[model samples]
Target chain A: MNVRIDTYQQAVSRILRFDRVQRTAHWANALLFGILMLTALLLYFPGLSGIVGRRALVVNIHVWTGIALPVPLLISLLGPWGARMRRDLRRVNKWTRDEIAWLWALGRRAPRVVDKFNPGQKLNSLFVGGSIVVMLATGIVLKWFQFFPVSWRMGATFVHDVLAFAIFVVVIGHIIFALAHPESMRSMVKGWVTEGWAARHAPAWLREETGEMEEDQSVAHSD
Target chain B: MTTTAKGAPDQKAGVTIAVGRRVFLGMTALGLAGIVFGARLESVLDSGLQRLFPWWPGFRIYSISGSYPMISEAEYRLEISGLVDRPRVFTLADLKAMPSTSFSQEFQCVTGWTVPNVEWEGVKLSDILDEAGVRQGATALSFESYDGADSESLTLYQAQLPDVIVAYRMLGAPVTTEHGGPVRLYVGPMFGYKSLKWLSAIRVVDQVIPGYWEQNGYPLNGWRDGSTGPTDLALTGGVA
Candidate 1:
């Protein structure tokens, strides 16, 4: 009877929410972006720059960090180790009508159905991906301004500044959201979430994980 | 000073004023104090901090102009005039034919970027000044770029520094147009900006005339660490 009880408890225990590859990629991206932001600030502000000193070193850190920004993501998308990440990327890109409804119904009676990522998370991922590419291009132009035309350089400067400000705001928002959702934060770090937590927060994802039909919305609320 | 003298209400004595005499005097004194000491002290303190911690953070070049004027070697000419016996022009070839000195020194920007041990080769600025035979009362020299957008001035003493040169070659190659080359001024001891780019004309002046950057709040003595006499580019307004 005790062994049967233990087996039942194990069935309801922690289930893998993020694979090791996904966790690695996410953490690596976060760290690189954090360093890039810090170094960028030191380079941009005169007062801050004076405190930090060694501007060339700061520039190198910023440039090389930006260059390596996509490396983890790209690596995570390769090989059998990346299968889960690859599927999640597709799911994140494929927005269903319920996801849109969930976003619209936010702050009201919201839909209980959420996949591995909600609409907001998907949007954030898209934005972060697009920003990394744009920022890298503009940053390269800024670093090698002499190679480009003056007009192009000026435009790149303006875009880089505006996008950096936007990224700073979004990244802050991303951290805040992560902090607000304690289970989600733990899931990213630990590569798992308890079955009960997944059932509550990501019912459709839990069903998909359990080899159940993904199409049925009738029981979207697992609770 | 000329503008101040012209604009001074000092002579307008006792005309019915809104404020009381003491209040007026106080405000005037405060304003004058802010004018003279505030800017100068801020710059002095700022550069002082830099000297103490020469480790600057960031790489950027500051330029006042949007366009660069790149005159080719054929078109490039260095005109030496004003307070000179022989106010003559030296072609690029003429400059190249003259004795050239080569040395590697740190190219330090005022805005806090340094390209260290940059190899520069060119004619000594003093040699040309000597050739021109500066008039007895000449106290300073003015440099104008072919670009028409930039100008620089140095006291006669500063202009003749052993390392100050009219550089035609840099980094083992003919100076590129982007580096302000073909002919450019290289002032070794001071900030890189004092070394104006794009060789064009040099005019000896009676007093220090602030360059474009100077007029825009840069110290007249743009030494790396306030290493030279500021001597008040402020005082030279009337003389220039």
Candidate 2:
């Protein structure tokens, strides 16, 4: 009976792992980010632009994509996922002692309690979100550079390039981590992780999801 | 003891003289420092930013004609017609005979590149217009290239700006064929497009007419000073 109950609870947890809203926003944001990265790469590298041909077309597409990037994000805010996104945003802003300890330990030791997002993931999200805002602002100024003073335009370009470099480094780091942990990728793609995988990696999070302290305690002891 | 002009003692006058000399020296030092700082600041603002980017020779050449048109100096004639009471034609020598003025200006292209402190010497467009006797109703001037491949227009006001001239020389030398020799329109505060190259003819008109690039979707009023004028170009299709 105990084993059967455990199996039933695990199935429930798997189903509730990632809802449609979160999955949609994640994929949409990723798609936009990929487009932005490719266009930026082409624009920054003159050789690449030469190879691509049709520089005007590439530039137009890049400008349009950059302008349209925030659409999905803004749309997501009006849907059922809005509250969840807000909660995640609030959660990411604060770093708990356990999170700091987990970071210091370099994942060698687990935190006493973990939420839906790990500290690193939270930081990554915050950075990417902040970067998008900055990129959008600078991009608008650059596109309408004629409207602004030369010094202001130059300053905007400087800031935009610096931020792009910083974001590029952070994105590479994010990709490396994602590749290192295939389970994380699977969770983003398939919207579910196995009970065992969750217990091993995010045991505290799994406990919170299950809402059974005694059962989680037993599982912890067994491990 | 020697007496001063004010009948003061030589000792007191000597002290006053010393103080005056010191004050004069301080002011001279400050003035020299200020001039140096001002020059440095101007240089940085002028060409330092341009140096940060790849520098191209001969004004970052862009021509719709595919190739730069070569006009022999002997055959070149600038025709001034349309809303002029006295329509006239001037040869290269005739333009050269006119009084010439030179000024240092930054050239800004509509495509977002700039060349700074280009010394252009030419007869002012206003002087030419005045010689042709511009009619009262003339509102704008249409400039055509020698090859007739491209043309640009400027409002009468824009053409009359102090820096607006029909340039035949750049950097103290005659303008090269590659850089619109013989004569090219130079509207200093406007984009390079408005400063039409390979000039051939000018026609004063009653209304603003779009030029080559302007017709192909560039701002009609390409002001480099970032002023949102009444006739500011309305960008369409992300061209500019």
| lDDT of every model, 2 decimals | 0.70, 0.68
Determine which window of 10 residues in candidate 2 chain A has minimal summed lDDT.
A46-55
Relative to the unseen true structure, what is the C-alpha lDDT of residue B162 in candidate 1, on a scale of 0 to 100? 89
Q: Candidates' interface RMSDs, in order?
A: 27.0, 24.1
The alpha-carbon deviation from the true structure for residue B41 of candidate 1, after best TM-score superposition, in angstroms, is 38
User: What is the lDDT, from 0 to 100, of the residue A189 in candidate 2?
Assistant: 79
Reference contacts preserved by each model: 0.00, 0.01
All candidates' TM-scores? 0.49, 0.56
Per-model B-chain TM-score: 0.70, 0.72
Model 1 lDDT per residue over B1-240, tens place:
121222123222312221222332443344334323433443345455456645432234333344456688898889999999999999999998989999998676553335556899999999999999999989998899876767888889888778989999998899876678789998887776688878689999888888865654456766655432345463342232
Q: Model 1's A-chain: what TM-score?
A: 0.86
What C-alpha RMSD separates each model from the true structure?
22.0, 19.6
Report per-candidate DockQ.
0.01, 0.01
